[model samples]
Structure formats: C-alpha cells, structure tokens
Target: MTAKVALVTGATQGLGLALVEGLAARMSTEDTVYLTGRDAGRVAQAVEALPAGGARVRGEVLDVAGPHEAGRLAERLAERHGGVDIVFGNAVMRVGPEDDPREIVGAYAEVNNFGTTRLLRAFAPLLRDGGRFLVVASSFGTLNHLAPALHGRFDGLSSLDEVDKQVAVWRDAVADGSARGGDWPGFVNIPSKIGQVAAVRALAGERREADLARDILLAAVCPGMMNTPTSAMWWDVRDAPSPAQAAEVLLDLVFRPVDPAQYGGLVRDGEVLPWR
Candidate 1:
C-alpha cells in the first residue's frame, strides 16, 4: 500500500509547529509530511529541529493567503505524491483593537477567509478519496457572536453561493462601517472567523455529493485557548494549555476514522459542538 501524504500550513511556530511535530511523530516510514510557512528561514529551522523518523519530513515556504502559491503547491504535490491524504489549514492572522479597522478587516479576510477558500479550491482536487481536510477555526466564529439575522443567514447556508453571499454581506458591512455597529460587533478576529466557519459549513453542504462519491471529509476545529504568542496579545495565557497539548487534540482528529455525521461541524476538545 502507498504511504499517506499529509500537509500542514503555517507550521513554523505556535500551534501550527506543534501540530507538525505531532503528525511527524505518528507517521510511518513510507509516509511523508510537509511543513509549510511563509518564512523560509523559520521553515528550515523547524524542519531541522523536528525529531527524525523513517517518515520523510520536509519544509517549504508557503503563504496561504496567496492563491498562486496554493495552486502551485497543489500541483507539485500531485506530481510527486499523486495526491494528498490529509491537509491541516492552520495559517491565520490576527489584529488588535488598537489597529486601524480597515487594516484589521483586510488582514482577517485575506488570511483567514480568502486564504481558507483558496486552499480548498486549489487542493480539493488533489485530496485523494477518503481524505480529510481540517481547518483551524475558533469559537469566536460561532453564530452565538453574530447578530440574529446574520446568524440566520449563516445557519441557513446550504450551498457555496449562499456562503459567498454571506461573506459579501460581512465584507460590505466592514466597508460601510456597519460591522462595527450594534448588529455586527466590530472585533477584528471574530468576523474573519465567522466567515471561515460559514464557508466550511457551505462547502460541506455543497460538496456532500462529491464527498460521498470521493469519501472526503471536511471539518473545522477550534484548539481552545492555547498559550501562544498570538493568544498572549489578547488574553492571559497562563491558564491555557500549551501549544503541544492543543496539537495532541488536533492530531487526534486528523488520524481518527472519518464519520459522515460529523461533516461540516465545529469541533472542540474532541467533541462536535453546535455552531449556533
């Protein structure tokens, strides 16, 4: 049997790096895992530091926000390994309350929303049958934080068109300053995550037929609060789990058997959580 191929994005540090290490440790001799980040130097350092194993661990520079880069990576993976068996979309960007609203919104959408979509579009074709796609998501993205109407629209999404429409609404709100209004709550990171969660739901619904035919499973998971640099910027990290602990939970999901019933849902602490 051919060995499995796994890829983790934004894996130079924090939770992403820990995830790469966990995945690498679990791989068989024939398997290959690719660890990617935007910084070549960081990627090289990470690759060198990971524990050596029979499974080949390689590092590459990849910015998930770049569509061209995503496409190229997918193409290269196809050429070398036939297709990918698992993908962990872990790259993200966060902005503080003091930052300019426009910059915050743009960064969130570019890195979290569009970036996730681009990876899905580019790599969906390359995901082999019975493969898994996991997006690192957050509880902040849940419908509970969104306005009732916006929440309804997101919850009602059953296709990619609906998902696109919902994202456009948020984008428009951001442009018009309405996202900062009573209904939308103008936090820099939440809206971006909201868009990501909605897209995952829509993609799961839209791809249901294809997923069934191809045996592909798609899911979004929140690693809970982790004591990472990004989290330190906002919350007190003293109470949170270390990145390595969070990585263990994430890797568990990656290796578990696919369950059709859980498709398109948000998972936290190993259990499926209701989006609303």
Candidate 2:
C-alpha cells in the first residue's frame, strides 16, 4: 500500500483501539497513524499495546469536543504531512442509566453531535485525493428513528445548517421535558446519532459541490454490536462479537475501494442500510 497518513479519534480502547491496531498492520512503515484520546497516559499505553508493524503509530492528546483542539491538530497535520489520507471520527460519549439526564445533555449535544461537526470542519479540507472520512456511527442513527410526522422535516437534507436545526429542535424539546412523551425519540442519544449521520450526508454533498479534483469519500459506518466495555454499558454482549472481530470486518470494508453508491450512506456489514 502507498504511504498514507491516518487518524482515529478516541483510540485508547475498545473499537477505536481495534481500528488503530488494524491500520497499523496494513500500513507501510512510511505511513503514519495517529491514535488520539483525551488522556495522555492512556493514549501512550494504547500505542505501546500495538503489535510491531511497518506503520508509524503515534499518540495524540485530543478532546474532540473541546474547543479549538481539532482545528489545531488539523493545522499540525497540514504542516507535517501536507494532508491526511484517512480519518475515522470515532470519539463519543455513551451515557449510562445511572447518569443524570440533565448533566449528560451537553455531552450528547456537544460530543456526539457538534463534536462530529467539528471533526468534519477541521479535517474535511485536509483529506487528500481519494481520501476517506468514515464516522463510527450506529444503525440507530438512521432516519427510521424519527416519527412519521417528523420524517418530512429531514427530507432532502442538503446542509449542515439544516442538521443543526434538527438538533436544536431536540434540544428545545429536552429543555421543556417534552422529549419523553412527545414526537422525539425518548433516548437522548438517538437525536445525536441522527445528527451525526445527517451531518455526514450534508458534508458529502458539500464536498461534491466544491468540485475538487480529489475524490474524497465520506460516510457513516455501523460496526455492528461489539462486546466492548462501551457496548456492555447499555446492552447484553453475550451475542455480540469481540471488538477485534468487528474491527476486522470494518477494516475489510475500509480498505476496499468504495463505489459512489456507498458514499454518504450508513453502512453496516458491507451493505448500506435504509435511511428512511
């Protein structure tokens, strides 16, 4: 494979670490793979845990939701590597049942929703010709989560602004305590997941409109159910595959050349799921 520069956010553990490990094995020695997390020690440990490989694995301290960090990392990458070939937006906050709903609202709003927006804004331009940006999203993010009455509101979503409007509506509902019994999905994470997928679609459109010579492929991918710490927090994991197993599946898809039909879609197990 050609020397490529890749970045995977929240790579200290679980699926994120699995992705980094997979990439490290496939990449050439000249290639660079950056694994990032908010914690420096954990990031270092994750890098150290990787098996010996040709790829140059580096750890970066990055809080995707924190202000200006993604942009700064983008600048550094631009200066050092000219641009990046692959980006995996995998950082997320998974809320638990014991957590206070009010206290956790900002995490879902900022990390899951706007954190994705921030990653796209900072890294989209840095994608080299034929580069790919894949968001680690869930099937739950699909438009099927929306009520029938609200489906029309998201139709023909063509801009980030439109996605933001949808997020704002969810936020408003939450603030008013109407989200539970109203048109919105009861789970706070649902709207943010929807926002992530919608944002990826909108950004893909914007990239096409720019008409750049680069064929930058962008999409959201669901890695299916994994028996990771994060997954075990919410659901039964006995039937789920190990993080390494799911990573193998996901990396297989990532390494393949994606056709236009796959772009901007929510992919799972090599197939694009129905958005509507």
Candidate 3:
C-alpha cells in the first residue's frame, strides 16, 4: 500500500509543530509528512525534532503570504507525491490593538484570508479524491462579532467572490476610519478569521458537486485557546490549553471519517458548530 502524504503550514512552533508531531506519530513507514515555515533553518530543525520513526518527514521553506511561493510549493508537492491526502492550513498572523489599523488589517487579510485562498487554488488540483482540507480558524470568527448589518452581509455570502467583496468592504472601512465608528470592531484578526470561515463555506458550496463526486471535504476548525506565542502576544493565556492538547483535537478530525453535514462548517472542542 502507498503511504499517505500530509502537509502542515507554519510547522516551526506552537500548534503547527504539535500537529506535525502528532500526525507523524500515527504514520507508518510508507507515509511522508511535510513541515513548512518561512525560515529554512527552523523548518529543518522541526523536521529533525520529529520522532517519525520509519516514516519520512521533510522540510520546506514556505511563506504562505507570498504570491509565487504557494504555487511553486504546490507544484513541487505534485511532482514529489503525485497528490496530497490532507492539508492543514495553520499559518496565520496576529495583530494587537495598539498596532496601526491599516497595516494590521492589510497584513492580516493578505496572510490569513488571501493566503488561504491562494493555497486552496494552488493545491485543489493536487488534492486526491476523498482528500481533506482543514483551515485552523477561531471562535472569534463567529459573525456575532460584527453588527447585525455586517453580520447579515457576511452570513449571507454564497460564493468566494462575495467573500472577497465583503473583505474588500472591511478593508475600505478600515482605510476610511469607518471601522472604528461603532459598526466595526476595529480589530483585524477577527474579521480576517471570519473571512476564512466565509471562504470555506463559499468554496464548499461552489464545489459541492465536485466534492461529492470526488469525496473531498473542507472544514474550518478552532483549536480553542492555546498557550502559543501568538495568543500570548495579544491576550491572556495563563489558563489556556497546551499546544499538544489542541493538536490532538485536530489530529482526531484528520483521522476520522468525514461527515458531509459538517462540511464547510466550523468545529471546536471536537463538535461542529453552526456557521451563523
């Protein structure tokens, strides 16, 4: 039997590294898992630290936000593995309240939102039938974070184009100082995650037929409050779960059978939550 292939982005530390290790622990001699990070040295170090045993663990330098890198990585994976069996979209950027609003919003959107779309576009063709694409999202991404009007706009989105349009609206609001005027939260992270969930829903809906035909599944998941550098930098993580615990939840979903009803939905604590 051929070994399955898996890819995890931002695998240098925190949840990403934990997930890579957890997945590696479950693999057989034939399996291969790729660990990606912006820093080549870090990626190499991470790969070396994994106890993959007989399974092959490789490192790739990747900046998910880069325009050309995603495509290049996808092509390389295709040539090396024929196609990927699973993708864990875990790379993200966190912005604090004190940061410049415009820069935060732009950087978050580019990394968390557009970068995800770019990965999906580049890797979709390389995803074999019955493959899984999981986006690590957050509870804060729930539309309740926005005003009713904005909530409706985001919740009612039915396509990737609409999601892009909604993101553009938020970008415009940030640029014009309207995002601070009671209606918007003035924080970039929440909206960026909301865009991720929205994009998952839209992509799933648009690809429903293909998904069924190919047995492909897509989902957004919240790993809960973990004690990671990103969380520590922005909020209190004194009581948060360790990255290993969160990685277990993610790995459980990855190994379990796909549930069509939960496709394109948000999951937390191992339970699927309503998209709205």
Best by TM-score: 2
Worst 10 residues of 3 by lDDT: 48-57
Off by over 4 Å in 3: 52-54
- Model 1, 45-103: lDDT tens digits are 99999888756888878897775898999989899999998899989876664677754
Per-residue accuracy of model 2 over 1-276 as CA lDDT, tens digit each: 446999999899899998998988888889999999999999999899888977899999999889699999999999998999989999998888777656677667877777888899999889887788899888988878888877766667888778878777777777667777778876777777878898998888877644234566788999888897766888899888988888887787668776577788888888888888
Global Cα RMSD, each model = 1.9, 1.9, 1.8
TM-score of each: 0.92, 0.93, 0.93
> Per-residue CA lDDT of candidate 3, range 71-153, in tens?
99999988888999889998987666578887567777778888887777787668887788889998877887766777876
Q: Model 3: what TM-score?
A: 0.93
In order, the Cα lDDT scores of the candidates are 0.81, 0.84, 0.82
Worst 10 residues of 2 by lDDT: 208-217
Model 1: residue 268 alpha-carbon error in angstroms: 1.0
Among all windows of ten consecutive residues in candidate 1, which has the lowest summed lDDT? 97-106
Sorted on TM-score, highest at the top, how do the candidates line up?
2, 3, 1
Off by over 4 Å in 1: 159-162, 209-215
| Model 1, residue pairs in steric clash | none
Candidate 1 whole-model C-alpha lDDT, 0 to 1: 0.81
- Which whole-number lDDT from 0 to 100 does residue 55 have in model 1? 69
